[model samples]
Target: MAGASVKVAVRVRPFNSRETSKESKCIIQMSGNTTTIINPKAPKETKSFNFDYSYWSHTSVSQNYFKKDIKMK
Candidate 1:
C-alpha cells in the first residue's frame, strides 16, 4: 500500500535495440504507487507534449506545493 499523499515517479529507459539507433524513454507519474503512466512511450526531446506535465507542475507552484498534495485536476 502507498500513502494517499505520495507522488512517486517511475522511469523506464527502454532501449530500441532495433534498427533505430534512438534510445527511447518512458516516464510515469505514479500516484500513491498506482502507476498511472501518462507517457510510457514518448520521444523525450522530440515530443511536443513533454512539457505538458512537468512544465505546469514546476511553473504553477512552488517547491513546497506538495505540502498540500496539489495536482492539476
Candidate 2:
C-alpha cells in the first residue's frame, strides 16, 4: 500500500418528493473539485471541501452533462 494515492468525489442528488413538497432549497454547491454546503440557519455560514472530482446531479441538465463529461474523460 506504499505510495498509493487516494481519490475521492462527491455528488449532489436531486431532491425527493418530500423535499420538493416542502419547498426546500438546495444547500449544496459543486464547482470543479470543490463542494460547498451552506447552513440553512445561517446563509453566510458555508463549508467547502476539495476532492478529486465534484459532480452536480441535482437537476436533469446537470445529470446529462455529467454523463457526457464522464464519457469524454
Candidate 3:
C-alpha cells in the first residue's frame, strides 16, 4: 500500500454563554494559514501553529468550505 498524508485543520467557534457572562475575551487570531493563540493568564506568552485550512465561526459573516481546496490521490 502507498503511504498517505493526512490533512489537518482548525476551526474556531464563538464563546459560549457561560464564557461571555464571565467577560472572557477571545485570544485566538488567524492570519492566512497560521493560527496564533495567546495565553490569557500570561499575556506575554503565545503559541502559533499552521494548518492546511482554518474556519472562523465567530463572525457575523457567512463562511463556506470549498471542496476544491482538498485534493485526494
Candidate 4:
C-alpha cells in the first residue's frame, strides 16, 4: 500500500437480476475522491466520505480509466 496506509476504493456495480427486477434505486454518488451515500428511508439525509480512490465503474467500465487514475508508490 502506498504510504503504508489503507486505501479505500469504492466501485459501484450494475444492478443484478434481483435488483433489476425489483427496480432498486442507487443512492450512491461519487465525485473526485469523495463518495456520498443517500439514506433510503430519508432522502434529505446523506453522508459523504473521502478516500484514496473512487472508481465509478457503475456508469462506465474502462480498464484504461481505472489504470490511469490508480497509482502505486
Question: Each prediction's TM-score against the native?
Answer: 0.21, 0.75, 0.72, 0.70
Q: Candidate 2's residue-wise lDDT over 1-73, tens digit each?
A: 9999998877777889999999998887666676678899998999989888766767754543233342112
Candidates 1 and 2 compared: the better one by lDDT is 2
Candidate 1 vs candidate 2: the TM-score winner is 2
- The ten-residue window of minimal lDDT in model 4 covers 64-73
Give me the candidate number with maximum lDDT. 2
Error of 4 at 1 (Å): 12
**Local accuracy of candidate 4 as per-residue lDDT tens digits, 25-71:** 87877666777888999988999898887766554434322333432
Q: How displaced is residue 71 in candidate 3, in Å? A: 16
RMSD of candidate 4 to the truth, in angstroms, is 6.2
lDDT tens digits by residue: candidate 3, 1-73: 5898888888777889999899887787676667788898998898989888777765443333222232222
Ranking by TM-score: 2, 3, 4, 1
Q: Model 1 TM-score?
A: 0.21
Give lDDT per model, in order. 0.33, 0.70, 0.69, 0.68
* All candidates in order of lDDT, best leading: 2, 3, 4, 1
Answer with 1 or 4, whichever has the higher lDDT. Answer: 4
Give the range where candidate 3 is weakest over 10 consecutive residues by summed lDDT.
64-73
Which one is best on TM-score?
2
Residue 42 miss distance in model 3 (angstroms): 2.7
